[model samples]
Target: MDVQEKCRSWTADHLRDSGDCYYQAVTRTSGGTEVEFRGTWVIMAASHDYLGLSADPRVREAAVAAVRRFGTSLGGSRAACGSLDLHEELEGRLARFLGHEAAAVLPSGFQANLMLAPLLADGSYVFSDSSNHASLNEVIRLGDAKERTFLHGDLTHLEELLASVGEDSGKLILTDGIFSVDGDLCNLPDMMKLADSCGAHVVVDSSHDLGVLGPNGAGASDHFGLRPLLVTSALSKSLASVGGVIAGPADIIYYLRFHARTSLFTAAASPANVAAALAALDILQSEPERRVRVLDLAEQLHNGLRALGYDTGSSVTPIVPVLIRGRERCLRMWRELCRAGVFTTPMTYPAVRAGREVLRVTLTAAHTDEQLMRVLDAFEAVGRNEAEHPR
Candidate 1:
């Protein structure tokens, strides 16, 4: 079949099994641990609210107060005088929280990667991880710089590729702090040491790890005590806010503020959203127990699921993927689990390897022991159900 026909056929096939799959919105929320899907309240094991700050009363109040004061949107780009005090405050707090010299908040994490490409790609050769998110993938493909892809988390492949390029050539390496699909960390300490040996610079997308990793929830870099040249993260995930930020040297951030076209021209982030992120930072600083709690939940689930005979891959983070290995099997499990009132994401081909599909379960700090038990029971029941009813 032609490309369009193939895509249409794929969509048709996906729709046949996906009941309330993609594009289904939550009608109600409770404690940030459960969401209403298809008019049924289901435990949210697929959400990214790691610290549960998204539903915190303090965060809600802060966002509400900002809306009352600033009236919803900023309505223009930061460069067009749409910038608010909250923007500056969040940037400062993120820089301090992540131990960076400076930081600039962008409209979204996708745009943050785009902004960095122009600044860093001008004189560099990009060496990217094969499993890096689509944002970083697009940057490498579209930027002016030449690029190469190393095997996912394979330092040997990276070293070989780096050796092929000139030592004097400016090098930019991009990777995820915690890979969303596999939930494995990047080995930043080793990566940084290798980069140093070759005089290359590294940039990390800490969207999944920031506020959920490290000594004080400082992210992967802090977890390893290595400072990359630049680091980026999305506030929407852990911070329960809507925006992204890049923390790096003051000079680079200054250049991006003036030159990054997306951040320069796109409407500034909403004041309330920025305030919510600020409150999230406060919680990260004060309630370190929240971080511990979430990690403990992740470990419990990871261990429990493995003990029950499901393959969890190599996850060490809140993002755990239960590898069911077939599209039909994965979807059937997802459908059964949802019916059992446990919602999870079934990741099939294109999101994961063709034969390594998974049911992605993302745990949050707000998830209670009772809820966790319920989810585990539901999974066991669903897996048994899947085996009884074949595709």
Candidate 2:
């Protein structure tokens, strides 16, 4: 069959057996947050706006001024006619912010990984962490490098894999600085030591860790004092924008600027996005206390959950996972929480192992103590109800 027919068949099959999924599209008003689905005001605890900079007046003004000056679209790839002053400014600012020699901007974090992996060609081996994000997995699959999976947070496994690679082969060790699902940090110091011993270059994806971890939010590397060969992150998360960046040696960034398919073929980030990211970076740099607040909120939530007898997996950061035994219970709990005006994402199946379904609670600096208490109360009520119902 043709492409349209095949897509229809696949969609039919998938939807036929799909379970109910809940989502709320929120509309912001001057007074409070409103949910389009429920048509009522609701508190938000689901967004990744870690520092609440997304709606900051200064950030919004910067974005607006950029749009007014440069218009909305780049209309071509960066290498062609899309390269603009804003793009260069953002890249330069990001490189300086992260203390990297240079940086290249990509359309998204997924594309950043996808492009970076393939840059390491033949005679190379990619030693990847087991708990890395799916984008990194896709990057490895597309690359020609021989792949080895090391157990998550296990430096011993990583060392063994590095040793297995051929002596002359160039090795790249890739890991998430902060795991997305569990919010646990990678053992960067140990990983760096192992990579150094094996003469392997390290690339860390600090998608979740940036703007929340590290001193002044420089990310996990700054937090641990282990300088990697490269670092990549998304502006969509903590920066509250719509692009990705790869920061490393100046020569490597120049190579990717010219050759990385994602950057060469895709249109440059809009001026507004670049401006917002720049403003966010300035805010992050100026207000070091925001990072501290995020850590404090994470500690408070983790402690509260543990005290209430919830099984929070080994998380020490803003991402907290409350383990639910089964998929059905997980979905039910999620629905119950939503019904009670608590918004959260349910992670299961391919995102995690089948039996490891969880309610992923992300904390942000914008959230107040009262809001967190409400979230804790909602969890307690849901857990109690689930226990009583046994389904």
Q: In order, what lDDT does every prediction score? A: 0.88, 0.82
Candidate 2, 1-391: lDDT as tens digits: 9999999998886455334453335665321122333565455656677777887788889999999998998798888888888888889998987889999887788877876855668778998889999989888888888889989888887888887778888899899999988889998887788777788888999999899887768899989877798999989878878889999999988988877777888888888998999998889889888788878988999999999899888998888888987877787788788777677778878789999998888767777788788889888898788778874
In candidate 1 the C-alpha lDDT for residue 101 amounts to 90
lDDT of 2: 0.82
Question: What TM-score, computed on C-alpha atoms, does each candidate reach?
Answer: 0.96, 0.94
**Tens digit per residue, CA lDDT, model 1, 1-391:** 8999999998887778774566778899999999998899999998898999888999999999999999888789998979888899989989988889999998788888887767556667899999998889887766878888999999999999999988798988899999989999998888988999998889999999998998988899988988899999988888998889999999999988897787888999888889999998999889999999999999999998988888899998899989997777787778789889998888887888899898999889999999999999998887776677756
Q: For every model in order, what is the number of clashing pairs?
A: 0, 0
Q: Look at candidate 2 and tell me the lDDT of residue 100.
A: 92
Q: Model 1: runs farther than 4 Å from truth? A: 1-13, 17-19, 120-123
Error of 1 at 225 (Å): 0.9
